[model samples]
Target: MIDEATARERVVSTADRLFYAHGVQAVGMDTVRAESGVSLKRIYALFPSKDDLVLAVLRHRTNQWNTGIAGAVADAVTPRDKVLAIFDFLAAWFREDSFRGCAFINVFGELGGGSNRVAEAVRAQKASFQCRVAELVRAAGGPGYLAPQLVLLAEGAQTTAAISQDPDTAAHARAAAETLIRCALGDSENAPTV
Candidate 1:
């Protein structure tokens, strides 16, 4: 018999991919069963409803995505570098063939109006991303206002990158972020742009 945890993992992973690729409303638990090979009864036992499965997928994906960003920024030697590295990470992600911008952004557009639960989950990812940026700003000795500005740049880059199918947009966003950071830090004119 498949272990409960393994089964749960497969279901969530499969659902995350489907929901991300095709939008949440397009995918159903039957499809999850078809792709994941978990029995329908087990899927129901694991997730009582499609909404429950959607929540599970979003929560799982948020953790997985955040972990990737944390790992990508881990090698930066300074807080400022860490802030810049976020765009670097996004650049890499945007380059992938499977890239379709932020999953939360996609989900919000799809179901944010009809479902409070979905809206909350989608909003939570944005909130968390902005919160992390604020923390990074504090660490970098930048003013509090800069974090939201940086988040806007990043979010805009993501939207443009997805819609325009251009990976270089990530670099563009990073450059803008650098300019904002330098200005906020009151860098001398001689400060070299990275």
Candidate 2:
């Protein structure tokens, strides 16, 4: 028999794949059980409810994604490099055959503006990403306004790349972001010194 910890991990792993491949609402508890090979009773015993399970899955995915972004940014030697790493990371993601767009954005879009546990998780994750970008911008000596503009452009680029199947759109967005950073730092040509 599988231990409780292993069973829980299997359940979360299965749910994460399903949620990313299919919309959150499209996946059901039964599907999780079927894929995980865990009994329904066991799943319920661990998760309590589908919403609880969804939150767990979201949290797991969020941690993994945050770690990846942090790792990518850590390799950069400067704040400007770190900011540009966001685009580079997204570009690599677009190259993946399994790429299905941002899972949080997709779930939020599917849920349609509701205040629930899942929505709260999504909002927090988004805010965290924005905050990280803002921090990087400040470290790069960009003015306060530059962070929000870069965040918006980054989000827009993700949406466009996901919808239009045009990864190159990120390049345009990156150029725009660089210009914003330059303007924020009172430099017309070069990026800010950090």
Candidate 3:
């Protein structure tokens, strides 16, 4: 007998990859079963429903995605630099061949209106990410408004980069963010005199 825990992990892992690569609405349970090699009975035994599997994948991907972005900018000399490093990190992610934009944004576009759970899960991820950005902004000695504005820039950069298939969108956003941060911090010695 396949262990239930093992089966659950396999299903969620498979679901995450497929659902992220293909929108959740597009991938069916059978495809998951075929790709995972987990029997349908075992899949149902673990998740009982497609919705459940999707939730598991969203939660898992949210954690993984947030962790990855955080990890990418963990090594900065200053808080402002750390915030700037986020753009650099995004450029790297955008360049990946497998890059498919933000999973939360993709799923929300597909099912946010019909699925409350998906909307909430995606909302939670955005809120959590904003909170992290707020912390970084605080460390950087930015004003209160800077946090939300910075998150906005980050989100806008993500979507623009994906839509344009331009990895340098992050760099453009970074320039704007630099101006905002300096404005917030009242530090413009580095700002161009032009």
The numbered model that scores best in TM-score is: 1
lDDT by residue (tens digit), candidate 3, 36-75: 9899988998888888888898888877877877886687
Pairs clashing in candidate 3? none
lDDT of 1 by residue, 1-194 (tens): 79999999999999988988998889877899999999999999999988788889889978977997798779787788888888988998998999988888888898889889989998888899999989998998889999999999999999999999999999999989989999899775533276
Q: Against the hidden reference, what TM-scores do the models get?
A: 0.95, 0.91, 0.92
Instruction: Give Cα distance to truth, residue 111, candidate 1, Å.
Output: 0.9
Q: Which candidate is the best by lDDT?
A: 1
Tell me the whole-model lDDT of each prediction, alpha carbons only. Answer: 0.89, 0.83, 0.84
Clashing pairs in 1: none
lDDT of 2 by residue, 1-194 (tens): 89999999999999989988887789999999999999999999999988788788888978987887898899887788788778777777776777777878887787637547778989998899999998998888777788889889888887888888888877777778776776666663445333
- Give one clash count per candidate, in the order shown: 0, 0, 0
| Candidate 2: clashing pairs of residues | none
How would the candidate models be sorted by TM-score, starting from the highest? 1, 3, 2
Runs in model 2 lying further than 4 Å from the true structure: 112-115, 188-194
